[model samples]
Target: YEPSEDALQVEVDTKTIPHTEFLTYVFTDLSSTGATVALDWAKKQIPFKIEFDVSAIVLADIRQKLQGEAGFQRQNWEQAATFAMNNGGDLQEALGWINNAIEGQFFSSKTFNNMAVKAQILQKLGQKDKVLAMVPEMAGMANTNEMNNLGYMLVNMGENDLALKYFKINAKNNPANANVFDSLGEAYKIMGDRKNAIKNLKKSLSLNPPAGVKANSERLLAELGVVI
Candidate 1:
């Protein structure tokens, strides 16, 4: 394994030991739990190799074990949920894991974050009403700064429409804040709504925002060929 290159080169002499035989032996020895355990052990043995190149069967085994052991722990459940979501192989399974994380604890710190992930999963699953239902809770939990950051984060992730949703929420909640409108404008611009972008950016500037906020609004307006 080359640490700098991040590549694992396995050399085997086919004359002395056939490649097929080696693979067969490895597979036979490392079945379900065995493969998972070996991967875990390898992570400990090999520094810089956080993830292993294992089969889907081994990953499924690990996920199953994690779910079974998650019992009442918000972080554990959230971790399992995140892993399932990142897997992207089964949206229903990801939804189940995130639901488990959300319901595991009544007053957990991870509850809101879990809800956000659930909303994303729901959106992917085409559950628009359910995703919309979560907006109040998510928006209520987030402050102006947090909401602004989240909206931009979604924009960076190319989720412009979803980002627009949060930006609208922030503008509604913090009507007096110039930054909120600025963020809303940026989201609208990314969503290709030039009219709304100009409207909100103009609103932001009119609010007498700080220099940075004023400059950003002006810049966006300039990009849209509107010098307001």
Candidate 2:
């Protein structure tokens, strides 16, 4: 297989070890216990200045295997996160590791997709506050249904602080979307923020909402004792 140009660079043995012996060392150390052994081997193999493409191939394979392992030990959380983000490995364990990655810069240069993966894991863990905290300022994450679902879930969980923040962000990001406005109105109503609730509900009605949205908004406006 071709060595990818995107190769990992680390430290290697100044004393030349034979390739067969290195492979033997790896399998003997890591195969059944999880991949940190190969990862350790690969880290030790990364020379300050790489001189051979053949070595890059082995290093890439070692990192790939390490990145794909599902080990859940707190010490292994970083690797678990890489596997979870890239390979759908373990949502629960990924949360712990991603938080660690964010804190420790383990992800090289974390992408918006990596942050989105964190949000996804938090949502799966039913952590409304954390997911809501993660959504704003997360670039390219504008799935309307996902926002509504998260907002409603927060509301159901009585996390009004997070729900209001989430729906307000959804409304701001999706100004003309009546469903977003309706969700915002419900959050405000739940907060006893009657004035904003009635205003958003009216805006939702005027935006030519989907079939059921108009009725829901009007009912909420009435419940807020506002004439709409």
Candidate 3:
């Protein structure tokens, strides 16, 4: 047997068997008379293998973009909660989403992140004891980002000293990140340490935030009566 660009050729010993019967079988199985036609055209002696070619078969591809769209529609509260928690680390927005999720019964029975989100919502809602209860569950799962988020929640709840500990951990892990400096500055400001606030805020600005963040940081510094 030999393979061509589009087909396979088979050689059979004509002395052993007649070509006509073999051609009929090949044509019947292939569902094409082209193989039989090619066999007749070949000048080689009988009992030779004939060449048959079939076009390549391809299956259609499926795209999964709709699955993502559906997931977003079905989990908007969770998505918004995650976004607000990560971006500004805003407690109110996180709490709003958590409350929405709870009232809507969106994802109340899930694992760690879900529990953490709910605990954070409680912290923002002034349920400090409840938030503290969830801390043990969150401790082993905590990362720099999680610590930063907890720090932000603590800051909003006027627990500046505790907030500083988490923010310091986050800053230590991510020294070059401007948001860490910004968060540390916010913590210092809450603690009534204007000098450290000014210093860290300046460090945040020095890292060269994007245009929007730079403008907002500048406005915040000005509000704090810092000459930035």
Which candidate leads in TM-score?
Answer: 1
| Candidate 3 local distance difference test against the native | 0.62
Each model's lDDT: 0.70, 0.64, 0.62
> Can you give the lDDT of residue 158 in candidate 3?
70
Write model 3 residue lDDT over 24-118, tens digit each, in one string.
32232334323332343233334333443322110000013213443234255565565555545556756765565545554443445666777
Model 2, runs deviating above 4 Å: 1-140
Best by lDDT: 1
Question: In candidate 2, residue 126 scores what lDDT?
Answer: 70
TM-score of each: 0.53, 0.42, 0.48
Q: How far is each candidate from the true structure, as Cα RMSD in Å?
A: 11.3, 18.0, 19.9
Q: Predictions ranked by TM-score, top down?
A: 1, 3, 2
